[model samples]
Target: MYQLNLARSLAAGSVFGQNAVKCSQMLVSEGKLEPESFNIAIGVAAKMRGQANLRAFHEHYLEKTSEFRANKVVRRFQEAIDSLSIGSLGNILVEARTTRIRPTTRSTGLDEGVRL
Candidate 1:
């Protein structure tokens, strides 16, 4: 878990970042990759637009236990990969951004004129 968290942090923020992907691949190859870890890798790959890494991770995920497929996060990651493959990633991003559940004044219970 520590390694997975470190890999995700490095992938998200480090200037020398491809190493993080390599670390994830090594974990997958050694059968040490958890479903959550794979989800993290998928997220990083999608954010970085690393098509090759995404494909590799997808293949590795498939080869793992069927129980992993039951994980919602893993399923979502797979859907993201599928969207990328079908060239609908841009549409998905636009829809997700436009459909966000913004906090309303009623929800926050603060006056609309009040500044934070």
Candidate 2:
């Protein structure tokens, strides 16, 4: 079940990431979005590829600008990120928690005599 859920999450994120790029391209072609608007989609795609563990909403800085003056592009990206299901997020959390390492106890040699 865990493997199935993870596969689905990856597939969904892949489709969503592609859709974002396509949407940005369409906007650019239609003159509704500036050429720079495509940068956000590119950034998202790069991050998604590099960090499979990251959720769409967890992607930071979709664009290079310190301040985003374009609301439409931002809105589109937000909508795309928001579409991810809660189950995917839960699965990611479960995977992360399971991989965390527990603290280890100090080992003492038998010849040295252990202190309690």
lDDT of the candidates, in the order given: 0.54, 0.48
> lDDT: which candidate is best?
1
Clash pairs of candidate 1?
none
Q: What is the lDDT of residue 18 in candidate 2?
A: 62
lDDT of residue 113 for candidate 2 = 58
Q: How many residue-pair clashes does candidate 1 contain?
A: 0
Q: What lDDT does candidate 1 reach at residue 64?
A: 75
> Largest TM-score belongs to which candidate?
2
Which residue pairs come into collision in candidate 2? none
lDDT of 2 by residue, 1-98 (tens): 34434544555757555644554555556775553455554544443543443333233433533334344445566566556543353334334554
Residue 89 deviation, candidate 2, in Å?
25
